[model samples]
Target: MKLLLTLCFTCALLITAESLNCHVCANQNCSTSTSVACPAFSVCSTVTLLRRSGTSTTVTVNKNCSTLPSCPSLLGSETEWSVNQGFAREARRQLCCITNDCNMRTLAVPNSVINGRQCPGCASSAESLNGSCNATVSCEGVEDRCFNSTTLNSTQLMIRGCISNNLCVLQAIFGDLLSGSIDITCGAPCSYRMSTLLLTFAVAAHKVLL
Candidate 1:
């Protein structure tokens, strides 16, 4: 009865709010973009994820309705935050707004914040993106989650080190977007092993500075 009543209330809210309209695209410029109606319970979003090695960087952009709880609406630039582990780093920027088709502007990677933390992990490139865990990393701001995950398919790729909570949500939801079995574990617990030789770590984050 209680659950039913809550559902009823939620449904009433959605009926009043209707559905949000957002842009849906990937790896495209959105300066002058088109729009599409989102699902019954989602919000407009433009999320960008990047992985960098030394001076080389790769970026992927996605615009669609999101159900992520963390990224509400910043209204401005992305938090100049990122995560770095040894040879590789991961950074994210999001532009979200409430209204009809508000995801405009091509967001650039903001300035990085040096929070003075260190971690260890492995990273790879989009091209030959599978490598062994043979690196120590420098953890960045808001990258409170230490990730150690792998893709369990024909081509198994292992990923590790500190990461952001936003990436956690995306990896969980879109782990299988590529053609393979992928496992993404961030800020894991203790240490585990995908196999005998392959060891993974999980550090408990407390009063995490994001």
Candidate 2:
């Protein structure tokens, strides 16, 4: 009788442990979907040029994340672990965007005649008039905003740049784990930490760009 009781107790304990373990996996997937859905500024709009002259330009601006589903709700239960995790993920992403200095590489334009006019000189005096001028120029201007968005399976984070022209620029993508609504629970800390850490690693390694 003692042996049978001991076996039964052990089996019950094992079952409980399995249930808890399942929670961990579920939480991880949820957090991942949230991160995937987190919208960055780039994904919302494409780069535009309001005015481009002599290697410089002034771009208009738009900074609204309402269209994105992943935009974190500032009004939700702040104390909840999922909320904290989401905020933390956003913070870590913002850090990466700032620290990594993710911007377009400006290619030097060669001095050449465009439509029978001498083209303006680039920073480098050496004009590429003789070389092929087909190279496209990618410049970084001010008024670029980043934000988060929610989606069905993944969160969409984007960064939209306002250029001189009236056009939307989609800059980058950060796919997270959660989608739709996030679960509010204490078991989300690990998921949040792991997701942010993965983002940091990808940024550092240049696998992900802003």
lDDT for 194 in candidate 2 is: 34
lDDT of 2 by residue, 1-210 (tens): 999967855553343332110011113212211111212221111111133434553333211112222322121111111111111211111101111112112112211211111111122212221222222222222212222222323442221111111111211222232223322111111111135777788788895454
Alpha-carbon shift of residue 73 in model 1 (angstroms): 8.7
Off by over 4 Å in 2: 1-51, 69-131, 134-210
What tens digits encode model 1's per-residue C-alpha lDDT throughout 114-209?
544445576445422656566655566566556666777777666566665655666533353333567766655322223433322212232243
Off by over 4 Å in 1: 1-28, 34-42, 58-86, 95-98, 105-111, 123-132, 166-171, 174-180, 188-210
Going through the candidates in the order shown, the clash numbers are 4, 56
Against the unseen true structure, what C-alpha lDDT does each candidate score?
Answer: 0.58, 0.23
